[model samples]
Target: MDFAGTDAAEKATYSTLTALMYRACEPIDDDTSVLARVVGCSVRTFKKSLEQLIRKKLILQLENGNLWSVQIEEELKNCNENLNRLSERAIKAANTKRNKQKDNSSREHDEVMTTSSRGHDNIMMSSSRQHINNNIYNKKLKLSF
Candidate 1:
C-alpha cells in the first residue's frame, strides 16, 4: 500500500510508535527518555517522531506527554479506503461522459451527411428534368429544306 508522507525511515519510526501503542492497553504517561528506550530510538528522534505522528493525525497526545487513541490507525485505514473508492468512481464518471460525447458527435455527423445526400439527389433530378424538356423542344423545331 502507498504510505502518506516522507521516506522509509520516518515510516519505520511511525510503525514502531504504533506498535508500542497497540502493545500497551491503556494510555502511556512515560517520560520521553523511557519511551525512547522502549522503541530503541534516541530521545530526540523519539520526540520528533511523536510530533510527526500527532501532526499526521495518526496519534493523539494528551496532557503531560500521555498518548491515547490507538484506534487512529484503523480510522486512517478506513479514510484511505474511502478515498480510493471515490477516485475510482470519479474516473468511471469521466469515461462515461467522454463516451456519450463521442456518440453524440457521431450521430450529428451522420445526420449532416444524410441531409447533404438528399440535397444532391434533388439537384440531380431537377437538372435531368430540364435536359429532357430541352430535348423535346429541339425535336419540335421546324426548318426549311
Candidate 2:
C-alpha cells in the first residue's frame, strides 16, 4: 500500500518485509546496518522506512528484536497446516495401495502351490498304475511258459 516514503525507501521497506515473510516465524538479524545491506539501501534510509512502517502499523518489532507482519504470519500458519493435512492423506493412500498389492501377490502364490500339489498327486497315481500292469504281464508270461 502507501509506504509513505521516497521510492528507494519504499522499496527498502518492501524488500525487508518480504525477507521477513520468507523466514516464516524465524527471527532475522535486527541490526539496521545488516538489514540495509540486505535490502541494498543506506542505513539511514532503511531506518526512516522502518519507522514509517511501524507508525502505520504495518509491521511490528517484537521484544525479541525480530520484525513480524501479522498478516503474513497468519497466512503462513494456514499454509503450513494445509500442507500437513495433504501430506497425511497422501501417505494414507499409498499405504492402502501397497496393502492391496501384497494381498494380490499372496493370492497368486497360493494358487500356484495348490496347482503344484495336484500335479504331484497325479504323477504318483500314474506311477502306481504302471507298476501294477507290469506285474500282471510278468505273471502271465510265467504261466504261459
Candidate 3:
C-alpha cells in the first residue's frame, strides 16, 4: 500500500522486491543490470531502488553477492513441508484402502469355497440315494419275474 501512491521510486522498489520474492526459495544474483532489465528500469534507478530496499531491511545481500528475502524462503519451506505431509497422508490412505479391499476379497473367496464344498457334498448324497433306489427297483422286478 505504501507503494500505491504517486511515487515512481517506491513502485520500482516494490517491483524489485516482488521480483526477488518471485524467485521462490532461491537467491537471485546481485546483478543490477539484469535486475534493471527485469524491473524495466535503468541500472541507476534499479540501484537506487535496491539501496532503498536494503536500507529498509526488506532484502538481504549475502556475502556471495546473492540477494534474498528471508520471508519468502521461510514461506516456501513451509509450503514444501505441507505438501510432503499431504503426500504421505494420501499414500497411507491408499494403502489402507487397498488392504481393506484385499481382505474383503479373501473373505469372499473363502465363502465361495465353503459354499461350493457344501454343494458338492449335496450332489454326492443325491447320487448315492439314486443308485440305491435303482438297485431296489431291479431287485423287486427280478423277484416278480
Candidate 4:
C-alpha cells in the first residue's frame, strides 16, 4: 500500500499497468495497440512501460503478450512474509545479547563477592594470630618474673 521507495515513473508505469491489466482481464480482446491508443502513448513507449512494469515485478508479461497482475499480489505477499521473518530474527538476536550480558554481570558480581569474603577471612586470621602471640608473650613474662 505504501509506495515510499518507488519513483514517480515507476508509479506511473504501475498505474498504467493496472489499467492495462484490468482491460486485459475482461472478456473482450486484450489488444495492446488499442490499449496504447487509449492511454495516449506511443506503442513503443507502451512497450517500454510494460517492460518497466515487468522489471519492477508489478506486472506479469505472458508469452502471448497478455499482461497479468498476478506478480503484484505475489510480490506484496512475499514482502510481508520476509519483513516478518527479519523482524523475528532481530528480536531473537537482541534477546540473546541481553541474556549474555545479564549472565556476565552475574558472574562478575559472584567473583567480587568471593574476593571480598576472602579478604575478610584473611583479616580475621591475621588478627587471631596476633592475639595468640600476645597471650604467649604475656605467659612467658609471668613465668620469668
Q: Which parts of model 3 are misplaced by more than 4 Å? A: 1-6, 12-21, 127-145
| lDDT per model vs. reference | 0.75, 0.78, 0.79, 0.71
Which candidate should be chosen as best, given TM-score against the real structure? 2
User: Distance from true position, residue 48, model 4, in Å?
Assistant: 18
RMSD of each: 11.9, 3.3, 4.0, 11.7
Q: Could you give candidate 4's per-residue lDDT for residues 69-124 as a string of tens digits?
A: 77555655687799999999999999999999999999999999999999999999
Give the count of colliding residue pairs in each prediction: 0, 0, 0, 0
Query: In candidate 1, how many Å is residue 64 off?
Result: 25
Per-residue lDDT, model 2, residue 96, is: 99
Better of 2 and 4 by TM-score: 2
Give each model a TM-score.
Answer: 0.44, 0.79, 0.72, 0.44
Per-residue lDDT of candidate 3, residues 24-82 (tens digit): 45887787788788788888888887777776766788899888877677788899999
Q: RMSD of candidate 1 to the true fold?
A: 11.9
Report how far off residue 52 is in candidate 1 (Å): 15
Better of 1 and 3 by lDDT: 3
Error of 1 at 47 (Å): 5.5
User: 3 or 4, which is superior by lDDT?
Assistant: 3
lDDT minimum window of 10 residues, candidate 3: 1-10
